[model samples]
Target: MIPAPFDYARAGSVEEAISLLGSDPDAKVLAGGHSLLPAMRLRIARPSMLVDIGRIADLSYVREDGDRIAIGALTRHHDVANAEVLQQLCPIVAHAAGQIGDPQVRHMGTIGGSVAHGDPAGDLPSVLLALDAGFVAQGPTGTRTVAATGFFTSLFETALAPDEVLTEIRVPKATAGWSFMKFQRRAQDWAVVGVSAVRANGGVHVGLTNMGLTPLRAVGVEEAVGGGADPASAAARADEGTAPPDDAFGSAEYRRQLVKVLVRRALEEALP
Candidate 1:
């Protein structure tokens, strides 16, 4: 399927990309194009213009910033998975990145693009949510930070304004006690259900994927853990606040049950 005809403009920098997006109210930013291109081909998205920001080299790095690790928005999934700094400080992120799609997709997909797409089935967003990461967005006004908890608002919708471009992702240094579990019927397929659990800040945090309109923190599970509940007891609450989707992959009820099992396994591994 061919995408509807649209104007294209390559941005040399983030500022140029923001300006291009501002030039047209219906303009969409293009990074790796993994998500947007498919939506366009299906005619689900028909932006009048595409502001290509794929060539912005400055926004493709991973580095340490004091007690946090800052990842440039354009950093590829492959790089994020392999970056030594992330491997040492935030291994769950690196592990989750490695589990996304396959090698080709990892090579082409940008962390920023995946996060900005706001897909509920995306593996990284759930990990970021459990870790309580922060996203930095830049627009005409200036830069502002959005917490992962509030960043995702709905299915394929985010708190980012139309003119805002996500520039960086910041995660706290979580050295150990973390696990990411994804359940899929086939290799490189989207997760039917996923769980990310990390022990940080004197407590355990849990995030769920494909269990709601947006990636969601398993608040009930987290609260249970905080109250000194065992892994099985904490995981039993996995379906308390979720609204999993019913589709070809699995039924919502199946996912609700699966999440409980995965959460228990993840908690056991993370809290061991």
Candidate 2:
């Protein structure tokens, strides 16, 4: 398959990338190109221009800031998976990042790309949601922080403005237990149903992947946990508000049952 031809502009900085996006209304920002390139090849994405931000060196770091760990948007998944700070402070995120695709994909893909792509099946978004992470969007108007809960609006859709560039991700240091459980048919494949559970603020926070139009919080499970329900009872509510797609690998009903099981496993691993 051939993609539509597009003009290319390599940005040296985040502001420049945002500027390029502003100048071309239909331009797409290219990071690792893992997400956009595939869509382009399939003719599902047809942008007039591609603003390449992969060369922006400053946007590829993982550091500690105040009570949070800040990860630059360009930080590669491989780096994230091996980051000492993330491993010690946020092992769930590191583990999830490592589980994405394979070694080659992890080496090329970026945390910013995964989060910004807003793919429902992506591993990182659900973990971020469970961690209550925040994203920093930079544009000509300056920067604004978007909460993970609100960042993902729909399938392959995000709250970022057209001219904004996701600059960094901020996650609070995890002082409690956390776990990620993914049910996949094959190695390095997308999860059929994924569950991320994190003990936060003295309560359990759970997020579901490929369970709805967007990576979603297991509101029913969260409420059940808050109300003193056991893991099995809370897990039973895993499908309460989800709308999983009925694909060939599994039907919606199958996904519902899978999520319940995975959530229970995740909760057991996350809770003491």
Task: Tell me the TM-score of each prediction against the true structure.
Answer: 0.99, 0.99
Q: Write the per-residue lDDT of candidate 1 for residues 138-220, one digit (tens) a residue.
A: 99999999999999999999999999999999999997799899999999999999999999767799999999999999999
lDDT of each: 0.95, 0.93
- Give the C-alpha miss distance for residue 142 in model 1, angstroms: 0.5
Best by lDDT: 1
lDDT string, candidate 2, 1-272, tens digits: 89999999999888789889999899999999998999999999999999999999999999999999999999999999999999998888889999999998999999999999999999999999999999999999899999999999988999999999999999999959988998899999989999999998778999999999999999999899889888999899999889998998799999999999999998888888
Error of 1 at 157 (Å): 0.3
Worst 10 residues of 1 by lDDT: 198-207
The residue-level lDDT of candidate 1 at 104 comes to 89
Clashes of 1: 0
**Which pairs clash (backbone N, Cα, C closer than 3 Å) in model 1?**
none
